[model samples]
Target chain A: MLEFLERIGWFVGLVLVQVLVLSHVHIYGYATPFLYIFFVLSLNSGIDRNILLIWAFAIGLTVDIFCNTPGMHTAAITLVAFLRQPILKGVVIKEVEEEFEPCISTMGFFPYLKYTLLCTLIFCSVVEMIDTFSFFDLKELGLKIITDTLITLVCIFCVEAVFRRDKSEERF
Target chain B: MRNLLDFLIKYKHWLLFIFLEVISFVLLFRFNGYQGSVFFTSANVVTGKVYQMTNNLTGYFHLKTINSDLVQHNAELSIQLEHLKEAYKKLTADTTVIEQMKQEALMDCRLIKANVINNSTIHANNFITIDKGEADGVQKEMGVVSGSGIVGIVYQTSAHYAVIIPVLNSKSSISCKIRRSDYFGFLKWEGGSPEFAYIKDMPRHSIFEVGDTIVTSGHSAIFPSGVLVGTVDDVGDSNDGLSYSIRVKLFTDFARLNEVRVIERSNIEEQLELEESVVNKER
Candidate 1:
């Protein structure tokens, strides 16, 4: 119960930081890193594909409502949440996977970094691309993808670095 | 029956997720004009108490600004009172020419305070998360403008939070007309630049000049007429004759956006009812 409440608190905090502080941050004309995905990432490994999709849908829909997309984020987040299992299956070896949640610390040093970087980069790119609908020129599309991916990667790296934690600290 | 059971067994989780999402979509389509009021409106004691706490938090921040505005307003009122007294005495001695200022005096604007929670800017169609939700008095189609300028529209609201689609996103388009010529066009983001959006469907015959102001046309219920949208940067005609491609520099700096106002018309219900009746009669 405490852990559940703790997760809720964490979600709330991410939301606040995203809106109050992060929303104000723009790099090279692109703003908002969408670190809120961390909420879904932080969920335990045993989560079912169905529940994860719903969670992603709920979260995405929540974001969608706030942003007013026709169902864009919902579609993207749902895709990633559905894809999370397969992606993790490829990245996390069976032995280390038992030890921790999916992040730089839990999945082991190098594996965690690789996993977080790859997952977040993919997630942000796909969401942004879908949201934009492969607009006018290929150059603009490429630029948006690269820029979005870079910011997302850098953000994840910085956040993971600053809030350095060991596997044991997360399991609560 | 057997096939149905098999399908259900195969995709129960997907079905469940779809069910919730459909519910969300329904809420989005159903509500209009200030869903935030619903939370504060409910007679339920629990919701009322929760809103009270949230309102208290908002009040703590708003007091100083509100107080200063009232103080200046009070000073203005005192001067007006003296003038009114003098006018009262003159009514018996002279003809009164002061016509009642009704429409122009009531410039409709309301400030809605909502906490920012989950927001995305990188997405092609971005969303802003606010602590205010359906229960608070926010509704879909109500204009969401930040301190900077026109922000976006309220898309969805839960019990405690609402989302806005900012102008930077491609999906948002409002009918805007050049202030100088009064020639109208549709303003849409091309999703290329943050500072610019394209105005489509303007004919080549129309004039296109630099630094012309653009404002919303009150053609739709979304915004009142003459809300400052942006300025025309450049205009070009297409090879074909359909429309001109004009670029606009948006007035709102979406990057620095915070705090928005939701504009609700007083006669929205009447307008909606009249439209619905017309449609029904046509049917």
Candidate 2:
């Protein structure tokens, strides 16, 4: 359970990196790269679900605080966390039923990549939708999600290629 | 009941997640009620200090430019002084008349030097940041001006920095009047262009032409009379020979804005006293 707290530490560190470092990097115009979701997706397999939802809100609130968009991050991260059960069901093929976090350990390389990609996409899309639906123009709304999700996908690919290689080899 | 309680405990994080998300969403869609909830504005103390550090690091490279700006300002002052001297030489013959005119026309004011650090010209409600802040005696609602013309009014002040809503922002308007004809109107930025703005509320009877000099009407406490604003460019608020909107070419090139002088009105209290008396008598 203390390891659950440790996972949160990783999330905070990644969010700091997102706000401090990646927030400055603009591929063209869009800045936010959706790096914090790595925390939610990479929780321990034995992690509790209710706590996961709270974690989702914390991550989103943290982002909204830094970005000045109050409710957008909270809504998006919560939506992703709420849908994790079904999303995990769709991705995980193993028959094992022990409650665990959806991570690269239980779900293999291809399956994990697909899962992260879907979660990142859905989270980014949900956030962008909530963010721009108020006053942001349609063009801005569309571009925001597309670029954010694209950047997130690229970051997830890089993170996995670098971090999950040993685990994948051990599984194979 | 015991089994239901255990099941509810198992799903607590999910409920918490929904609760937190709802809280965040409520804040996101809310705009009107939340006026001071700007925790992310660069004007925040920690973030402002960070930017100040960055500005200090970058400020070293621009010393030469700042110095030249000071020198140019001095040169203009010297030229105006010479003009005043010449006018004095001619008017000394009628010293009594000139003295009376000067007493009625001249107002005492001082200028505080400041440098621009941040500016947002693209937003409809544009804002500019100045290096001078509350620590340097800058208070809210002080009039800001450039060498060329009136810039805007001070909106917010931090310890070491102040933010101004310039004439180019839709959220602000400056009272201006025609110099030759004494027609008064409110000048405003329409949220489209920086170099241009419109003067509203002028009656159709007001005669205006291109190249007419515009100045502050001195009707508002923020700006004193005779400060340059801009020149009349075009009239557009034509409805049915009732009212005409006049377009003004702003004197300050907001895009090229760098140095500014914050006008510190010394007699503000006394002026406010006189104004309040008038209002009290009226009431």
lDDT of each: 0.64, 0.74
Tens-digit lDDT string for candidate 2 (B42-68): 455664555466556766776787678
Error of 2 at B34 (Å): 8.7
Tell me how each candidate scores on DockQ against the true complex: 0.28, 0.31
Question: Of the candidates shown, which would achieve the greatest DockQ relative to the real structure?
Answer: 2
TM-score of chain A of 1: 0.81
lDDT of 1 by residue, B76-163 (tens): 8899989986976677544343333333435454556764444455545565656676677777777876544477777655566666
Q: List residue ranges in candidate 1 displaced over 4 A.
A: A1-20, A39-78, A92-108, A134-137, A158-172, B1-123, B126-173, B216-227, B257-283
Task: Score residue B255 of candidate 1 by CA lDDT.
Answer: 47
Candidate with best lDDT: 2
- The TM-score obtained by model 2 is 0.63
